[model samples]
Target: MIRTVLVALPLIVFAIAGLLAPLLSPYDPTSGDLAAGLQPPSVDHLLGTDQLGRDQLSRLLHGAQISLAVTAAVLALSLTVGVVAGAVAGYLGGRIDRVISRVIDMAISLPGMLVALAVIGVRGPGVVNLVIAMSLWAWSPYARIARAKVAGMRDSPHLDALRLLGAGPVRVIGKHLLPPALGPCLVYASTDVGAIVLGVATLSFLGLGVPPPFAEWGQMLIEGRPFLASTWWLAYPPGIAITAVVFASNLLGERLAGGDERPSILRWILPARRDRTVCAKDDVVLRVQDLSVGYPRRVVADVSYEVRRGEVLAVVGESGSGKSTSVLAPFGLLDPTAVVTGSIGHTKRVGVVFQDNLAVFNPLRTIGSHVDEAVRNAGRRPVRRVSEELLALVGLPAVARSYPHELSGGMRQRVQIAIALAGEPELLIADEPTSALDVTVQAQLLDLLARLRDELSMAMIVVSHDLAVVSRLADNVAVMYAGRIVESGPLLTVINSPAHPYTRGLLDAVPRPGAAPGTRFRTMPGRGGAGPDDSAGCAFAPRCPIAVPACGQGRPVLDVVTAGHRSACPEEGV
Candidate 1:
C-alpha cells in the first residue's frame, strides 16, 4: 500500500496543482512584464522569469491545468466509449463482434500521433479539438482489453443465471459485465494518462495544440527551447515535470496490474537460443533426442523419437502423459513458463494441427482469412488461390466466408487441417485431431490424413490416448506412461505382442472385436499421470499391475526386445 502511494505521488501532486492552479499560481500566466524578461531566480519570482517575462512557477502551475485537463478529458471519453462498445460487441457476438474487433485492430495498428495530427489538421487546434484527436486512437486499446474480458465471460454461468432471472441485456451488461471490465480498463487508463499527457505536449510542441498565450507544458517547452542556453530553468522545469508524471503513471499502473514484482529486463533484451545440436538422416524428417519439458519441474524427460519420410509415428498415451508437451515444446508453442531443453532436428518446415478447433481459431475471423494468413506466412503467392486449393485438399472448399463459430466441429477440424497444410510442410504433427469428433467424422479425418500422407510423402506424428484411433493411421507406435515411453515398435508388432504391462493395460482397454453387448470395458487400477522426477524409480511403478519390489528400485531404460521393437520393462531383462 505504501509503495503504491509512493508510485502515485507525482500524478497526485500534478492533479492537485492542475485543479488549484488559480490558488497556487502567484500571477496571471499569460500577462508578461517585457522589462523583466529572461530574469534569473529571485525572491519575487522563485523559479525565475521566461523570455516573455511570465512567472515560470505560475506558468508551470497553469500548464499543469491545461496538460492534465486534456489528458483527463481524453481518457474519460475514450474509456467510456471503448468499454461500452467492446462490452456490447462481446456480449452480442457474430457480425457485431467481428466488425468491432476489426475496427479495434485497425485503430490499434494506426500510429496514434498520425491519427492525432490528421484530426488536428482538419480542425484548427484547441483544447476540445486536441482532446478529440487523442481520443480517436486512444479508445481502441481499452476497447480491445474490454472485449477480451467480456468475451470470456459472455457464456459464463453467472450471466446465464442473470438471463434466466429475466434480466435484460442492458442491466446484465451495465451492472455485471461492465464493472469487472472496468477494473482492468482503469489499470490501463492509469498508464494511458501518461501517453495522453505526452501526446498533448508533443502536439503543442509542433504548434498543433493550445494556441499562443495559453500555458501548456508543451507550449512552455517550445517557448523555452530558443532560450535553453541562457536560462536552463526554462526547459528543465517542464521537462522534469513531464518526465516525473510519465514515470509515476507507469509505476502506478504496474503496481495495480501485478503488485510490486517487476519482470526481468534481461528476459526481453536477450534473444532465444535456437542452437540445433544434432543432425538427422536424410530419410528422417524429424529426430527428437533426450527432449525434456517442465514448468520448473520435470514433467517430461529423455523422450526421443524419429519420423522417417512417408511414415507415421503415433505417440499413444492417456491424458497428462506429456505427449502434447513433448511435441509442442520443440516448436516453442508451450506457455512461457515452460522450461524446455533438448535437441530437435528436422530438415524442413513442420505443420501442426491441434484438437479443440474452436480454441485454435479466432471466432471473429473467417476460415478463409485464417488459411490465407498461414499461406502468406509460408511465402505462397496468389494467396486466395493457394488457400482455396489447400481448403479443397482438406475437403473444406468454399467455406472461406464462414467464421469459426459458424462451422461444425468436423468442418472446423477440416479447416484446421487446411491451415496446417497451407505451409506444404514436410512433416505434420496432429495433436489428438480426432478426439472430439464423432466416430464417423473421426474415421473420415483419419482417412483424409492417411491419403494426404501417401500423396505428399510427408512424415507425421499423431498424439492420441486411444490406441484404436491411431491403429489405422500409424506405421509405428510409441506408448507413454508417466512421461516415459514404456513401449515402442512397429504398429503391428507392439499392438499384437506388447511387452510392457502399461501397454498391455492400454490394449486391454480398447474395445475388442468379440465383446458382448453391455460388457464392462477393462480399466487400469490406479490413475496414470506422474512426472518423470516424481519418484526415484520408475514413474509407472505404482500403477503397474504386475509390479514387484524391484520395479520401483530404479528407473528402467528401454531395451531391445525384438527386431525394431523396444520395451522399458525391467522384467524383460534386456
Candidate 2:
C-alpha cells in the first residue's frame, strides 16, 4: 500500500499542479511590465521579471502545464501505436513478425532526440508538432518491450486453450494479451513521462515549442538566462519546478518498477462455472471422423475416434506420435501451417487442460479473470453460484486472488482444470495434465476427473504416455505409434489382453513394485520412429516383434478383432 501510494503521489501531484496552474499563477504570464525587466526577487514581483519583463513565477507555473500535457499526450500516442504494432507482430509471427520487428529496429536505430529535433525544426514548434515528434521516437521503446513480451507469450497454453474454446484472435488478444501487457507498458509509459517533459523543454529552449507569450518552461529558461547573473529568482523557480516534477516522476517510475507488479491472479480464477446440463441421450458427445493432421514434416492419416458422453477415451503414444496434434486439430487449435481435414460432430463446447499449466494462463490477468474469460467464451451466463462451485470443484477456493506465478505447479494445473470446467464443456480434452505433477497430485487430479465425470457427466479424451493414468481414467483406449492408432478397445480388453505389440510393450513396461530385486524391467525393442516420407506401410513394423513380411507393403486398416476391439495389424489375426 505504501509503495502504491509513493508510486502514485508524483503522478497525482503533477496532474494537480498542471490543472491548478491558471489559478495559482500570481500574474499574467504574457503581461510585460518593462519597468520590472531583469529585476531580481522583490516584494512586488515574487520571482522578479524575466528578459521580456513577464512574471517569471507566473510563467513557470503555466509552463508546467504545457510540459506535463505534452508528456501525457506523447506517452498516450506512443503507447497506443507501440502496443498495437507489437501485439500484431508477436502473435502472427513469421513474416509479419519479421517485418514489424525490422521496422521497430529501424526506428530505434535513429537518434531519438535528433529525430525529434529535426521533425520539430521542419514542422515548426507547437503542441501538435511536439507530440508527433516525441511519439515518432517514443513508440519504439514500447514496441520493443511489447514485442519481446508478446513473442514469448503468444504460444502460451492459455492462448491455445482459448483458441480451442472458439475464441477468435481479436477476442483472445483483447481480453487476454492486452490486459497483461498493459501493466508493464503503463509503467514504461509513465516513466517515460519525465523524459518526454525534458524533451519538450529542450525543444522549447531551441525555440521549437509554443511561441513566446505562451509561457513554457524552456522559454522561461531562455528568458531568464540573462537575469541568472543578477536575479536568481527569475531562473530558479521554474528550474526548481522542472527538477521537482522530473524527480517525482522518476521516483514514481522506480517504485512502480519495484512494486508487486505480477499480473492479476483473479484473471485466472473467477469466471469458471459448470452450467451446461447434460442429457443421457447424447451418448456420443464428441465425434471426430476421418481426422487427418498434416504437419510440414509428417501427417497423421485418417484417424477416427469417438468419445462417449461421460466416458473417457485415452490416446496413448510416445513423443511425436501426433496424439496431442490429433486432439488439438479437432478443437480447431492446430498451428497455422498444419492442415486438418475432418468433421468434428456434437462438439457444442470443448475444454482443454494443456500439458504445461504455467503457459495456460495470462501472466498479467488474475486467476478470476482467466476463469471469467473462459466462462464468457463458452457462451455461458454469468452465475456466481456456478463460479464458486467450480473454484471449489477444482480445489482452488483460496487461489482466486493469486496470479499464475504465485501458484505452485500443482496449484496451476488445478486452476487450469477450473478454467476448463468454466464453460461446462461437454467434451474435455486433457493433454498430459498430470505429466508435471508428483504421483500424489497426479492421483488426486485423476480422482478429481473421475468425480467430475460422475457428477457432471462430461465426456473426456485424456492423452497420456503413462498407461496407468489412462487405465485409471479411460473407459476406451487408443494406442498410437508414429502418428497412427495401432490398436483401440475397451480399457479392460486392451489392458488385460493387449493385442497390438506396442500396447503389450507399453503395459509390460510399467514397473511392478513387488517384482524380484535386480530384475530388468521389460523393454520394447526398436525405437518407434518414422520419417515424413516413409512409405504408406505399417508405421510400427520396425518395432513390432511380430511383424510379418506383408507388414512393410501397406498400412493395415483397423480391423475388428473382438466386440468393440480393433487392431491395425495382420499379426493380430494370426
- Report the number of the highest-TM-score candidate: 2
lDDT of 2 by residue, 306-388 (tens): 98777899999888787888778876787898878878786677888999888878886688767755654554443333445
TM-score of 2: 0.54
For model 1 the TM-score comes to 0.53
TM values, all candidates:
0.53, 0.54
Q: What do the candidate models score in CA lDDT, each in turn?
A: 0.86, 0.78
Error of 2 at 572 (Å): 5.4
Q: After best superposition, candidate 1 residue 463: deviation in angstroms?
A: 0.5
Error of 1 at 479 (Å): 0.8
